[model samples]
Target: MATLSNCFQPLKFSPKRHRFNSTSLFTRRCSVSATINQSKLDILLDSVKWDDKGLAVAIAQHVDTGAVLMQGFANRDALASTISSKKATFYSRSRSKLWTKGETSMNYINICDVFLDCDKDSILYLGKPDGPSCHTGSETCYYTSVFDSLHSSQAEGSKLAMTTLQSLEATILQRKAEISESSTAKPSWTRRLLLDNKLLCSKIREEADELCRTLEDSEEAPQTASEMADVLYHAMVLLSVRGVTMEEVLTVLRKRFSRSGIEEKRSRKLEGS
Candidate 1:
């Protein structure tokens, strides 16, 4: 099992200065060899710093799909337990107990690389999750992320949904290729879209406008999740047809999130105005 935290960030910490009175502190002398061995077990990393509450935050990631599982707080024992079991187990600060991740749903997040912060008080466990890490029945604690593939870990529980999405994405690609090949012999709608840039762009624009124009109606009938899925799928095809990868779209979104409100709006306005 591998962890799939695709992003990384540098950490900075500022701690208050303190003076240690060595004279008042008792020093226990031990054999040089024994001391060295103890040092190994007692080692702390700046990466895994314990927080003020003596708890460390652990983020779990999926390996192949690179989906994030869930975040938890871990005491030493919980960390050790996860390492020992090769599965996620955390200390419940509010419950005052241990929480075995996926215990209820059997969706275990297997650890791969464990990154400690500069202070060695926290950890980042990168790996693939077996099933939904969140108990709320969503793929992630986050309700929405444009990178739907990043929801694989959580969607593992919904075998049907996961399979359908995967198949749909693949099918769309294959269908486009097939349509392109057949279009050379017979100018079909799909072939025309591939050959005529203007037509393709017009169709994509139409789909986008239609998607934006339709609001989910709860009056006569509420919109089913499938309807939204269709809109999103069409949008994805529009991107694919334009030679844009999903990763690129997500990168733009990340930049948008990182920007301040004014900066963000200004950038968008610059593109338009």
Candidate 2:
């Protein structure tokens, strides 16, 4: 009779040599990817101390949208592969293997931003995702399916800018879609304009040009609040269309706002305005 080892030669010897200790350190990754740039990554990775377990936390989101897509963990090799391949990959505790997110889902989004938490143990991703991140066809890992977020005064205090932006964008997109599919809404000017992609595109361009003009008209004179609001709203609409978020745009604005108004305005002129 053959020994048991003869039937399972590979498993018999390899288990001893590998000495792998399994744990409940499972990572849930997004079906889509978000990028973490070298600069933000430099700060994050440098702050974290990987233990003997060789595991670190990573939170994935859409690159352009800044939606929290999924969360995962990384070993040294997985981190390297994520940056090297420029794709989201994670070490799966349940499966006890390395798995690239979206391999089965076919909705893998590319990376746009990677960030490290203050402690550096956690990583955050911001990117444009393709479709649902969860296997069950949910949009996010958290299954808090359908709750009212807008028009609640209490929510206003707790709203994250990005979260609010995401919600608003979704609402706008849905309404725009509804308007598009309706044949009897032609009498409604706003509905008609929203339905017409070309018209929307033109409005976006016009607002962009107006913003530029307002910025250059005079350094000391800020545009009328109405004009500014128009520009901002239209820009947000365009951003939603492009699968970007107001959060990312605000990040740029925050950086710009840090400088003296005159200094910032002058710098733009210096760059061939």
RMSD of 2: 19.0
lDDT of 1 by residue, 53-107 (tens): 7688887764433555578889877876666566678899889998888787776
How big is the RMSD of model 1? 18.8
lDDT of each: 0.53, 0.54
lDDT of 2: 0.54
Candidate 2 deviant stretches above 4 angstroms = 1-47, 126-131, 142-165, 177-189, 195-226, 232-273
lDDT of 1 at 233: 60
Best by lDDT: 2
